[model samples]
Target: MGFSAEWLSLREPADRAARDGPLAQQAAKAAGPNPLVVDFGCGTGATWRALAPYLPTGARWRFVDNEPALLAEAGRVAGENAELVEADLGEMDALPLAGASLVTASALLDLMPEAWVADLARRLDVPFYATLNYDGRMSWAPAHDDDAAVTAAFNQHQQGDKGMGPALGPNSADRTIALFEAAGFMVLSADSTWLLGPDKAPLQRELTNGIAQAANEAGAREAASWGRHRHAIADRTTCHIGHIDILALPTGNLQESTHVLR
Candidate 1:
């Protein structure tokens, strides 16, 4: 339950991205004429809000998530512009919306393995106008590059397997690229890196928790190693950072394609 109500209170996803240069540029590239934008894993609808301006006016957004509390909060945040679905990805399976354009997810993808992506892409009717997902990109402040021993240990720890099948925070970017291409996508692939300085608290905190989660999970088998990190994060004296690979690909070009113009 790391994604608490307190986390949502800290800031809006829109404002967080507005303040970030690299993310803003990538987001602009994802904009244009997407009519029915489906945001998978749309927690609190913050990701939707961040990409809302880019979608066509009078367009409706479909947000899917399994958490009722999160979906309810998203409903409250999104109002009329949003259609919240409180079920798994299976709830509203992907089927080309004929003219409907694009599918987006932020800070997801990495958690899932290749099979899930394949199924979703097939359902969505592959070759999405664009897709951007970020993950485990939590960072700590007063970052100590000099703390190599702890940091390296922590980096390896964070990049370690999350028992979710594939190692998410480690090398997911490459896997994502290959999967998309294999699915018949003409992809624009790039790594989207988010660096947090002390000024940005919410993003910074998210990074912090994410790093702590990774490290904790990574080192769970070793109690002594795990306990040390748990204590340090509670004390709040470290910094963390991570990256997500961004991809923009056309769909139905290979597996199947469709166009939606507003």
Candidate 2:
């Protein structure tokens, strides 16, 4: 299922804060001047907003997403330098990669199948910057006895098809990096974990509820009570949800290279 604009908006602040600044800057610098950056699953243009300031002046963007409503919302804020393309990302063969100097996506790779990611790596001759991929590490403060079980079920649910076939889930970042490296790209990645404190109570509560629902759907019947406990204490509890940001640049195509590191 496609994410709503409201959800995207709710998560934007954390995504912005958690992103690795130096890695993003490196991708921007590697893009050079007047680059045409194509963003897949753009989701109200958060990725563009996150990277625009670092990119050279005259940089343009193509925001691609399957949802028309989300694309329209992205267009509302993307202004003159951005173009909106409504297309299903599942069709890797028809992606709008022509004339693209850089490619980006946020919270997207973990939902894609391994084959799809490999295909994307083979087709991209430009630098690829992807962010906020889930890494399956989650912890809650004032831990509950059921926390581990609920989280395990949620992670399993994440592997179910989210639009593409079977997803890579927590393994997405490592798999994508390996694929890009095999295709001759130098990849750099950093932990971008969302460390939510009491100030982020709303997000923490919503995320806990989502996890509970996913866990229940994956057959963890006890997660309902676990969710209630977590939700009730959300305002006082802290959360650590692991995520990763990756920047992969094609060798020889870019002047700079960063060695792959965790």
Candidate 3:
């Protein structure tokens, strides 16, 4: 399904925090913020604000989003450092990241299948700071064991191909680490979770709906079960939690690479 402006507006803060916590920091320390950052599925430029502070002088934030509405908002949000690029990630050929110092996207990678992630990462073997992909279980307050059937069904729903080819589903969190490892990434560091509670958190809300919708779509049996499951856990509000993976991958052979490059 397509994303909503409300969704983007809601998750902006936590999204920004996730970006700041790990990937952005390492990138800034490793090579300075002047590096070219291409945000796949930029979505109103929420990720840009996080990347802004640590950024060195004259750094640029190139945002890519297929939706024109989002592009307008992203351009506005990105300010002087931002350059809005209107395009969809599925159209890999149309949107290339061969020269970018970093390729990043928040809550975007899991939406696509394994092949596409591989394709994009292959295009640019640079550091990628990807975060907020839902891992399919959310429990707040007292906390409890996650509903297995609901989790399984919901995961299938999340993986329900949103057209860019079959997505990696809730499992993408784990899959991403493996993907990066095989890609020759050195694996700098990571933030494995984004937990949300009754704090009325923005990203929490975005992910709550995602988990519920997935449960609803998985099938009637699961839909009915998760409905009660959610209600029963009212004592402790719960929703899917997302994780961030930060990497400092070398582009074009790190061993032979120089600090200064073309």
Candidate 4:
């Protein structure tokens, strides 16, 4: 199923907070002036919203997604500087990367398979910055007995086909890094983890329900009960979800940038 605009809206704040600033700056610097940035799987243009401030005003944006409704919503916010394209992300050959100074995606790579990701890496001649790739690590401040089971089941569900063969899921970041490195790109990476507290009850509630649904699908019998418990305590519970951001530049394109993790 495609992500709804409401869900993207709810998580946008957390996504903004969780992004790695230095990595974004590095990407912006590499892009230079008057660049064309192409975003894949662009959900309501959240990636653009997060990165726009750091990028040059002359930068133009191309947001691509399979869902026309989502593209429409993205276009509404991105205005004249943004061009929205409704296209299937499953078809990598059709990606609009021509004349792109930088290519980006947020919360996207984890849903694709290794072969697809590798093909994308090989196709990229410009700098690539991918953010918020799920790392499969999740935790709660007040842990429950069924947390491990629920988490395991949810992760299993994550690897299921997402219209791009078997998804890499949690392995996305590392695998993409290796593929880019092997393709002769210099890669830098950093943790972009979400630290959710009581103040983030809305997002935590949605996350709790979503995880429970995935767990139920994966045959976790306690999913319903776990969901109920988590949802009830959303006001007090703290959640930590791990994500990674990657900035890969073609070798000899930018030799002065150092690899640092923060």
Candidate 5:
């Protein structure tokens, strides 16, 4: 389930546009001044770039990823204030969380199992901010007959093991909220959908390809045909992909948890 830097770079703009800005602002405020933030699965530092401007001036960032190349690129992009740590998120027990004021991840939770997420929730005592978690809603303008089948198959594929046991897929946001709440955290969530038009042809094509691949892997017989048709009309089509941004603060302090976005 490794993603190339090129693919991550391609999706950066849409990712930025789709994230909940107000939620990020709330997270920044909740983190306090000069917070030390630990970002998991920080691919190419897009999440860092998206949140850095909203956070305090002297805030420190620790970017954790298992990919060395991505870590290098993140370090280069995030400047000297960022410390890159190469570690496997699948093995969360060994992760270092010392002195962290906030924990964050983007496009990550949906790929993990419920137990893993619960473990993370139990371990994290600080405020948590996660964005771009897939909510399983995919729509296309100028719809085709095979759209539903492909989407269903892809969603099914999303639930299969992705190195962390059975993934939560579209159920991630709700599961995350419940997990954190059970761990004494107050959670707030917001919709962060990606609306792709002709202007985003590259991302559209990549997304189509990825979906088709997943559907095919899930044993959808018409996936290849659907992919070909989608690619042919992608330049003229629009796609709406759903996601969620969440912020969780420890429940003890009502004042700090009250600053969440509605």
Candidate 6:
């Protein structure tokens, strides 16, 4: 399913906050001076904004996305040092990675199949920084009876084809780590959970609706009622959604390897 610009915009702040800043810094440092960074599924260039400050001032970026509107917004957000490439990531074999110092994607892996990720790992010899992959942990304050049922159903839906074959869903992070490791890369990971409270009611509401919809579609009989009950208490509730941030360093250079934070 295509994500709307509005939804991407709405989630930018939380996405930024939930990423691993130190890992990003390490990735930047490892890229050397004037690194060429290629970002996949880059929506509105949020990844650029999140990592630019920690990178070299002269760092150049290439933002890739299939959606023209998002590419336009990415150009605006990423400014003159950035170039935009409009391409579908589902077409894995055709993905461009030549001369890239680092390859990055945010909240994207979970939507891809295992084979696609393996192919990507084998294709790129550069270090990779991927963030916000769902890790299967979710919690709601003052838990409801149907929370488990709804969550299970939603996760089931997540594994279904999202135009990229069968999605890895919560298994994306582990799959990525294994793929990179098998390719001889050194990988590190950290938690980047979203802790949402009343202040983020809008995001919470949107998430609730999305989960409910996905659950219902996945054949959860209690999904509709669960959605209504969650919405009723959303204003006063807090949520914790788990995610993982991974940095995979290219093998072969010990001197450059020191740049990666353990």
Q: By lDDT, rank the candidates, best first.
A: 4, 2, 5, 6, 3, 1
Q: Kindly list the per-residue Cα lDDT of model 4 for residues 159-252, writing each as its tens digit.
A: 9998768998888999999999999898899889999999999899999999999999999999999999999999999999999999999976
Residue-level error in angstroms, candidate 3, position 241 = 1.1
Name the regions of candidate 1 deviating beyond 4 angstroms: 8-15, 18-34, 90-100, 126-164, 201-210, 220-240, 251-262
How much lDDT does each candidate structure score?
0.51, 0.89, 0.65, 0.90, 0.89, 0.87
The TM-score of predicted model 1 comes to 0.67
Model 3: CA > 4 A from native: 17-20, 31-33, 140-146, 201-209, 220-225, 228-240, 251-262
Q: RMSD, model 6, all Cα superposed?
A: 2.0
The estimated TM-scores of all candidates read: 0.67, 0.96, 0.81, 0.96, 0.96, 0.95
Candidate 2: clashing residue pairs, number: 0
The lDDT, on a scale of 0 to 1, for candidate 5 is 0.89
Clashes of 5: 0
Q: For model 2, how does the per-residue alpha-carbon lDDT over 88-185 read when each residue is reduced to its tens digit?
A: 89998778999998999999999899999999999988999999999999998888899889989999999899867889998899899899999998
Clashing pairs in 6: none
Candidate 6 C-alpha error for residue 245, in Å: 0.2
Off by over 4 Å in 2: 254-260
Window of ten residues with lowest summed lDDT in model 6: 253-262
Per-prediction RMSD in angstroms?
6.4, 1.3, 4.8, 1.4, 1.7, 2.0
For every model in order, what is the number of clashing pairs?
14, 0, 2, 0, 0, 0
Clashing pairs in 3: 112-167, 138-239
Cα shift from native, residue 5, model 1 (Å): 3.6
Query: Clashing pairs in model 2?
Result: none
